[model samples]
Target: MAMGRAHVSTDRPVAGRFRPVEITHRETNRVRWYADDLRTGRPFLVTRIGLPPDAGDAVRRAPSRVLRTAGIVSRLCPERTATVVETAVEGGFLWIVTAWIDGTPLDDVLAGEGAFDPVRAARTGLDLLDVLDAAHAGGLTHGELSPGEVFLRPGGPLVVAGYGLTGTTPAPRLTAPSYAAPEQARGEPAGPAADLWALGAILYALCEGRAPFRDRGRFEATLRGVDRLPLRAPVRAGPLTPVVQGLLCKEARERPTGAAVREALARVVREDTGVAPTAGPDTRPRGGHSPALLCAGREVSRRAVVLGAVPAAAGVAALVLAATRGLSGTATGTSSGPPPASASGPTGSGPPDSGRDEPEPGGRGAAPAPTGPPGSAGLPPGYRTLHAPEGFSVALPAGWQRLDTSGVSGLAYRVTFGADDDPRRLAVTYSERVGTDAVAVWRDDVEPLLRRSGGYRRIGGIRATTYRGREAADMEWFTAADGTRVRTFGRGFLLGGGRGFSLRWTTPADGWAEPGSREALRTFLRTFRP
Candidate 1:
């Protein structure tokens, strides 16, 4: 059995810094305190896990392993992961300090709110899957996941805590025996599959108001039940019944893969939100052009020629292409004639007829650009400025390389940048066949197609704008990409004479407002030179 830390006076500080103010939560082998840092005068949560006296090597390595794993996960998901500020091990106890989480623990929520509806539970399950996907991709397993470790903020996604606890103790199922996988109960090493079992338990608890395997009043007895007893069918799981049953399978090998689970959860979200799934495969090319290009003297509709000339202007086509091949393509407009030397020179026509009033150049009511310190001034560390041969420059984070480029013979070209495995990307496209009204292009040509995407939600009305003194328009919207919700911000403007440039930035929808994401967006907008 794990030893428990002895009670200390409230006035006394731990590790000469954290002063325990009150006990916030307690579990079988762990306890959490609402504490204050005496040195910094900041409030933080302090979690102390009791270690057996004979823990030996596990005890010696617990602090470092916990801190290192926490650091890795924090970087991958800054918004949804708890940031561990400090860790310490002394006298049979391992302590972890983290910033104050402005949310209610899942344990508390279940205790107070009872069983959740299928839709809400599915939303929470999707968030968990996303975190797990990133962690597993990075070669990490959160073996200690439980309802107690998940925090739910009002109007925000869940934030996960208690990473790096899988290997900290010698005994299997040390903290939550009822939630542990059958493999772990049998003394086998826990892995990603074990985490899925815990996720299943959490989902079961959310839908039924109790864990699938109820505790038998003792750790050994509960673990034995987990290893041998059959899972009770969930009565209130509704549409989530199959997923819960699949994940809780006693044989880890029989459980659903992460990708499968993600797809299932995405389907649930779509159903609940009334968003129909895509009807068929998206065969559109990345550049949005048809398979056969138009030849001289060939009869073609004006719209078809314009669309084929610059595939990027086909916004719906671009969305479909992004879904098929990751979001890593450029968008550009093209003229009827052959390619030109400079696509960014000038385009004198207004946007295609969309029945909307076109704003005059330097017009009033132009959407104001985001204000901040200029030109990468507020960029996060590790980003450097990139000067493109195409006469534009922007700052990008380290590890972002040019992923791909597309163009029409000579009239237009687009360059995309990011690591191959990265989910986010930036696309810069220049074209000689631009419409005069940026707002009309987005409203009339772009949005009609974007609406066809699942869960497509326009964040705001298209706004005529100016970028670097040129006529521009800004459009923001949310859509799903490969089962992950994604948000995109596009700004397209004309230099003059039917020539223009467009910049589009995309990131996971759940992380759009994270500090790092905000910094990146701000930097891209402030520094890009057309």
Candidate 2:
């Protein structure tokens, strides 16, 4: 189980972002339990219980909109060391929790800490583009970055934790699968340059802690050398390593905005606070107050950290400073808000198609996308689109071909409708951040290189039909040198960490010994959410 943990004397839920408690009722209308979240000790899921006395003033305006989305995610990285809270559990459930962060997430600390330190991992990739330039300029889009949502917490009481922002809103549920991208991991609609290609695979895992491409064994053909690789200056002290090789360019409009990635991480926090050498760009001293003002409204700290700028409507009073504590985007560059052009690109694409044309830095047309809003992209979200992450719910499987494309409003494609000769062996996938359960991935670095190919193995199966708000597990696995052992399944839903996630799948059941592999792994984990 490699480094795979789960027993420092168990507290439970601490596997991947530390899982804790999440005991939702029999779809008894979600909620009824969301008791704790003081930085992920875990609990919060009042996914809107029974409605009427007329939706009780919309569940009293949802714990103040999940504490104003954790006070606008702590004023967008006010020096990253999280803490967002909002709980109203048991029956009329509702929750919003944060703070179980502590270093090691540049995709699992660059797999083994190789090439980064480059100015402190280029100022932690410009403090994740200054909190994704205040959550896509107040629209939010951490679609699901990786390295388990890039954390790094070095020194005692330090910071840098973004653990998947409760599945971001307006419509989001494509958790970071190996820093996602290839058209949002073949599902789609992941903006903010797919969080700049998971921040250039965390600057290729800071020069090599563990990223260069995935699915191993030939590693997806080395991503054509990461879509035509070419980067140099790599030694360490990660202060924006030449702007994280220019925001790890694989095209998303050549990369840089979110206030130029927080002004290239405030010039590497003014050379890690020695604060002297000045002639070209920033040396500090713009006095309102400085001496590394520890965390308060956040000015800088975390080995010279200093990202500030959060007001895309900062709510829940930014969680009273985390007891307290804390923590952008664009193609290569362009900030000052207003750009995601309403989730740009796909439906009836091209004849004037546009994701606002950004790419060019690394050329080769770098992943052109956006396929919605214009002609309604591929349609869905029409009926005034409200789905919000309140509690959460989803379930797909019926004949399986529901696409509704164009800039996907929160996710769910459902294919396996493949025919033209029984070719669709068994592909039952599901997507739903129905409210945010926070997915932490890098899938154990692509499951040990996809189990070194000779036919993978990450199994578990038999038994099913257990439903309600949901919390399930079942399996039947295979990858058989080529047999692709059919009926497989995996489930661990709790989608309320922020919005929803913990989804799982696998289907190719010709064998795997008997009982249609337990009703096709219980119809792929019972069609999922409700």
Best by lDDT: 1
User: What does the lDDT read for residue 263 in candidate 2?
Assistant: 54
Off by over 4 Å in 2: 1-62, 67-115, 130-132, 135-261, 265-530
lDDT tens string, model 2, 1-530? 01111222213222123222322222111122222222412222222222222234545564555566556655644545355433332233333344333123343233322454455555455545545544554455665455544444322222433333333222122222345555543434767777766776666565555554543223223333444445444444344456666666656777765446555655665666656312121212342332123123222343343111111100000001000000000100000000011111112111111122331111111111110111211111221111214222232223333222111243532222222332223222233323221112212212333345445454321211111222221222344424444322332332223322222223343432233322222222222232
lDDT for 157 (candidate 1): 44
Q: What lDDT, from 0 to 1, does candidate 2 have?
A: 0.33
Which tens-of-lDDT digit does each residue in 1-530 have in candidate 1?
44646554546566678875545566667777756566543346788877766678887788888889988887655556787877887556788887655345666666644777776777677667667766765677888788878866422345788988788878775576788899999888899899999988999998999989888877778888989999999999999999999999999999998767766765776787776322211112333322122111112222232222122111111111111011122231110000000011022122211111322111111112221223434344788888888877888988987887767767777788777676777877777765656666666665666676666776545544344434455566667776777767666766656667767677776665454554465456545665
Q: lDDT (0-100) at residue 381 of candidate 2?
A: 24
Q: Give the TM-score of candidate 1.
A: 0.52
Q: How do all models score by TM-score?
A: 0.52, 0.23
